[model samples]
Target: MNVLEFLDSPELTPGTFEGDTWEPWRAVLSGAFGLPMDKGRARLFKRLSGGRKAPTSRVRELLVLAGRRSAKSNTSAAVAVYLATIGAEMDGLLDKLKPGERGVVGLIAVDRAQAKVLFRYIEGIFDASPVLSKLVSKRGAESIDLNNRVSLEVHTNSFKAVRGRTMIAALLDEACFYADENSASPDVELYRAIVPSLATTGGLLIAISSPWARKGLMYQKWKKHYGKNSDVLVVQGGTQDFNPTIDPRVIKEALEDDPEGARSEWLGQFREDISDFMRRDVVEQAARVEPLELPPCADTRYFGFADPAGGGKDEFTMAIGHRDGERVVVDVVRGRRGTPAQIVEEYAALFKDYRVSRITSDRFAGSWPADEFKKHGITCDQSAKPKSQLYVDSLARFNSGQVEIPPEDKLITQFCNLERRTARGGRDSVDHPSGGHDDRANAVAGLLAEAATRPANIIFECLDDGYEPEWHPYQMFS
Candidate 1:
């Protein structure tokens, strides 16, 4: 049976996917599979597909941009199940696999927890259908092997792991939110990795996600293909456009609270205020290949900065740096998860080793960091600038190759993930992405800013009566 017939048949999907709520998704699937559509659905197909005619053959790629609670995950799960079972056999996709090779249907999400949501939906559809349930030959935590040498798998976003697999279809859940420390553009890299695997089987690539910033692969595809004719089908709609059952009051309240976020969440619009703070290549250009941490040099006059945490979800991080001619070189960056007192003590010892008696830090915990550091014979002074301004000041140094940072993964990842947001007052603020931490990045930025802006220190040595005095310009002004 066709995908629409399978979804509508009560004996096939049972109590699941009832009513006209799934009509929008059915139209999407119809356009994707080159199936015939009614006049109304044809209009929707054109509207969503950028006013282009429906394809005469199945599209190789599809991009879905819809609002939250728009049934993207469920619809994707259904499509994956369909492609794995009946569609594979009917379309001769299984014949493309080599001998003893099993075809895969990969459902990849930003993380394991998100992948489970799609996996559970797939499990529910199979459990609800007698015909599809019988096709499940074996089921594992992250995979389900079917009887037809085709398997449905759940995977977290990883470009390396998805390579070399023969896939009939690959669904990217929440493609806009994919982030990786090792990659500058995780979504694009992952797409590149999955495409080669699908080339062997003539498989489908479907990316369904809500709009984020006006960047990333989702935005790029939307900008290029939306409302224009292209081989790749791009569909975008608001919450109600896809699922009308959601209450209007919820979205209304959200709009009242945060208009930009609400529009992105419920109206399917990309946020204009958020953008990347620094590019990965820019950060890499300032990073040294070897020596992740430098030992304290007696000849160097170091400046230290700390970002303190209360031993909770956040980490207490410290960074030490010194000025090298016109450039700032980060000597060391340390992060620890423990009680604030113990962390402060450890940082104080490290500071003393570098002969750094004074350090700058954010206004985190106020007088607590000052008091704690004072106990260990180190002076902690609150920075005159905020974290956002510190990042702003460091941006030029990073872009101009005036800073050298150690190749630390967490530190580099945090720096790469930082977002520069423009406020209504026309002021720009830099910060890490939501649900991400940037203690290491914050400390490094603070120290780098201090090292760059502060005047060079002058030291004079008194020699014999007639000898000329020598001056050293290496220390930072306390």
Candidate 2:
């Protein structure tokens, strides 16, 4: 039977989909598989199709960009399970698989937590039906072996991890927010890796995620393929468009807190407020294979910068670097979470060991960082310029290869996710993306800025008369 019919089975799967709760998904699925949708659902499908016409033929690829808690994971899991169990029985699907070859299905997530959610959904669906359960030859912690020779695997979001697999179908959950480390862009790397593998098996690829930045594979596809009536179906909708159960009051509350973030998270709209500030190629070119843990060299004058969090949700981070000709080589990066007094004591000792008597900070908790550092006979100076200026100078250094950073994942991620927000008067500001922290990036940038401003390393100095600066770098939106 078709997937819609299977899900709508009254006796066997009655409560699987409540009345109209899954109608939008069912409509999309019916269009994808060339099944018939009721007139009401057909109209609903057209209105929410994001400009693509339903194909008379089968859909080989699909991209769904919807808001969070919109039941995207459940829909993706359902599709994955259906393809695993029923693809072999379908004429065109598993017929492409090589003889005696088990078709591989992948459910990939940005992290373990998301992977677990998808894994459990598939597991629960299989467990609900005895008929479907009989198809499992083996069940694993994050995978299942179907008697039909289809191997289902759950994976963290890494293209390298999924390379060389013969896939029947792959679902990329929350693909837009796939954090990047080594690669310039995780979504692009994953797409480049999985798309070629699927060609061999003539398999299906489905990427579903809430709209994030205007970059990455999801955004690129949305711009290029969406509403073009092509083989790849790209659909965009708000949370309520697909899942009507989401309360409007909850969305209102989110919008009240952060309009830009809320729009992308619940309104299913790509954010215009954020874009990548630093180029990935430049950042990657400067990263060392390992972070330097060496002590201060006798001849090298070290500079230190700290982003203290005082045992809060954010990290307390410090970066130390020294000048070498025109280039600044980051020597050490230390980060931890602890009580304010403890963190201050530990970092003070480290700074002293590096021969750093005075350090730069962002003025944490109004004199606490300075007062605490004073206890250890260390001077903490509030940064003269804004953090935004530090980032701007750091970007300039990176573009010129004037700075070398350690190959730290946290630092790389923070740098890669940094956003350049521009205002109406053409004033530009830089900061981390929504739900992203830049403590390490901030420390590193601050250190680079500190090194560049040294009298020995000054490249250019500009003094303006009668110029009033009202905005600090830290007051981004303000």
Candidate 3:
């Protein structure tokens, strides 16, 4: 089949594709992969084949959430080759301006070396196959150009370089890892910046990777974009779903061989990599079982905090706080799963009784509860950043001694168990350590964000010159 035929193929498999038509170049790629040239391969091709769709391309933003070792890389390689051919074959969905009007297509990874790996995969694939090999004009580790109009260039995860060059399409591989590296990342800044080149001019963005830790731009977007956005297509397959080489029995054996690797590579999890960030031990050290002393005469601004979840086993956490100038000390109020009504009544009562200035929580999957707070006249909004970021923000303050938490604070126990998970493309996440206290971690974040902003004054009359630090963790959650 002609590469241009694959690039401009109009033949649609009636029920297979919903968005865009097939690019002829991609059809050639499917044939190479032994994928039948029929509707049957439409889902697989969209999932495994096309790059950001060109004029005849089917997808716009490709968000693939496959599991580890699921042939994600191999499938990704096929798409790269397809794009290279399209770029080489024609104007790449650009105007039919004679020829050579379209600029270069970008293949980005975490670094130049990794980018070369993908570039080389496509290069090698074409070099091996007679049909694909013909399109290969010049091939190297960093680049593969076809005919004249199209060029496939590999790049490290540098948003700057990516932004500088114009393109018909761009592919982001190992999204989870890059997201890890994008902490305060200019690269991420670049991704947001470059969206217009396509959104305005009609180009494509392909983001494909197994998950890394659960923080940063990719995770943040993945968390939100998949369910809500119409333009985004999120595809996921476990090792069993996408992996071509690994057998089910062998996969099970591999999991048994190394439970940690199994959790990360196959399950795309970050549990094993997290722990040891919070100053819980310090809180514990500062804790003491003091008597119920007389109350201080000065007024205090206390805040009851909560961390909402999007279900699937994430916790519903709450914390009550009192601000003393720079620091707002908090105690865990409640952390569990229940109806919005249950959560609101408990936190509201705590807020009123404690006279907390406000109540805050993460704006995630808890629509009903967050609304419930609104109905009751409670202040509520989503955390501006990820839990990891909030964790970092709070930790930075605590480390500088800018914030203070007595050992007796029940919330500190939850903080101590937080974990930083490993993500694809070198990203990491800060969550309650596996089987630890996420609710506690989230509550602290709420307290921290509130403190940094405009806050009420505290008339600090030392209520307890000597403190009582006896805190029972188990009973406190209730």
Candidate 4:
């Protein structure tokens, strides 16, 4: 019989099994292979579920790392349901919770809408299985309530929501997209919050997702912790490892259609989806190594930048630039929730630093930001277009391979986090979803805006016609 049948017996439970309660589940685990699942997966299930004596000491947490359409949703749903019903119907769930206390379990994701998908998967459990359907009411509980009332709840990628809750465990879906200061990567922060909640009860925190954007919390955790911890169960797989659900013919076409997309989704790596997204690598390739500091310029024809926020925190971005023959160098400054007057002052400081002749204000918030700048003796014109359109058009340089970028970590991070989605009219566009921070993207847009209009004149202070510059390389390079 399968796991469902094994869990039905009371004799297999504690005090009767002669061993830890976790041991009895292994026999049930061995039976999953009776189905049409991959033999490799069946073997893995046996290995992981073997003689489960008190779970892992250090690895109370479990992460199922797999590729797109790799049965993650089904696996996650089954696991959650299993915990809810196993051994006293989730009563023991609190016995080994993290932080050694009874606490709520958090199911966090990209946003409210995104979080609903996983919950829906879980709801299907009650519908599909005849045995489980009898035990659970026709309408399942809205939240992940256990048999005894302890439950799992969802919160969109809001750092504030995760901050105070006493979390026994957390199931992080699309963990790379959770909230940050300006991005949605809260690996450091979320772990900090989850640690205390699971301390007493020994809770498990499982972070599962198809890899995208390097350096986020999920990537960092996978890199630093994976093999080092023997207790944690990490199941990583590829599209090649899946069963009959995905057709081989379709996989071949998808791989051939967009090679980059396949690498990230199928291979479980962190990279961009160039197929649907306007390939920013096109711009990344054209970057040059310039000599100056703040903004690397093509040459010295300084122009102004204006990122006009709605004064209520809708958008905050700006870039001032100088061009040198198809080269665009930008120095960016940005802010949020500031009055139009305050923004004008910020731009005045930038104008002097950049020494620009023209300024483009992202006028979505409209006239107030630009008009406020006029009073401060800084003039800028309204750029009356959607930010998405401007971002896509600017990427022409990236697609053509004609931009230069620094090795700064945050800058590169934001660039990588930019995602592509299907837009109206059957076209694709690049954007950062609401869960992730977009400040770096704003800086990029500011840079791109300045690039759109190249200056006609060039000027540089006289240094030397005969003096030879020192030719030196860094110790790391040499």
- In order of appearance, the predictions have TM-scores of 0.90, 0.80, 0.47, 0.54
Local distance difference test values of all predictions, in order: 0.86, 0.80, 0.55, 0.54
Error of 3 at 240 (Å): 1.5
Model 1, 1-478: lDDT tens digits are 8888878878777877888887888888898888999999889888766677787678888999999999899888988998998889878999998999999999998888888898999999999888889989999998999999999999999988789899999999989988775565789999999999999999999999999998889999889878766568899888988999999999999998888888889998899989999998999888899799889754556779999998786789999988767888898999989988988999998887777788988975588999999998888899998888989998998999999999988788889989988876678999877556788899999998788665544344523431233445554453
Better of 3 and 4 by lDDT: 3
Which 10 residues in a row give candidate 2 its minimum summed lDDT?
Answer: 460-469
Clashes of 3: 29
Better of 1 and 3 by TM-score: 1
- With a 3 Å backbone cut-off (N, CA, C), the pairs that clash in candidate 2 are none
Model 2 alpha-carbon miss at residue 295, Å: 8.0
| Candidate 3 lDDT by residue in tens digits, 1-478 | 4433443334411222223333322442443323345664555544432332211334456666666665555546656666556533443354532354545667778655667677666665665566656656776657776764566777766666666455667778776565221122333665775675455335567777766555545666666655342455454445655544557786688678866657656765443454357555454543334421212223544555677654455556676655556555554345666665776777666555555435666756456656777766576666667667887777777666655543434355556555666554467667753223456557767777767774445333323421211223332110
Residue pairs with backbone atoms closer than 3 Å in model 1 (clashes) = 50-227
Residue 213, candidate 3: Cα error in Å is: 1.9
- In model 2, how large is the Cα lDDT of residue 323? 78
For model 2, how does the per-residue alpha-carbon lDDT over 238-322 read when each residue is reduced to its tens digit? 9998888989999999998878878999999998877789887788888887645666654445778988785665788998888
Backbone collision count in every prediction?
Answer: 1, 0, 29, 30
The reply for model 3, stretches above 4 Å from the true place, is 1-57, 87-102, 129-141, 179-183, 199-201, 225-229, 253-261, 268-478
- Model 4 local distance difference test score: 0.54
Off by over 4 Å in 1: 310-314, 336-345, 366-375, 460-478
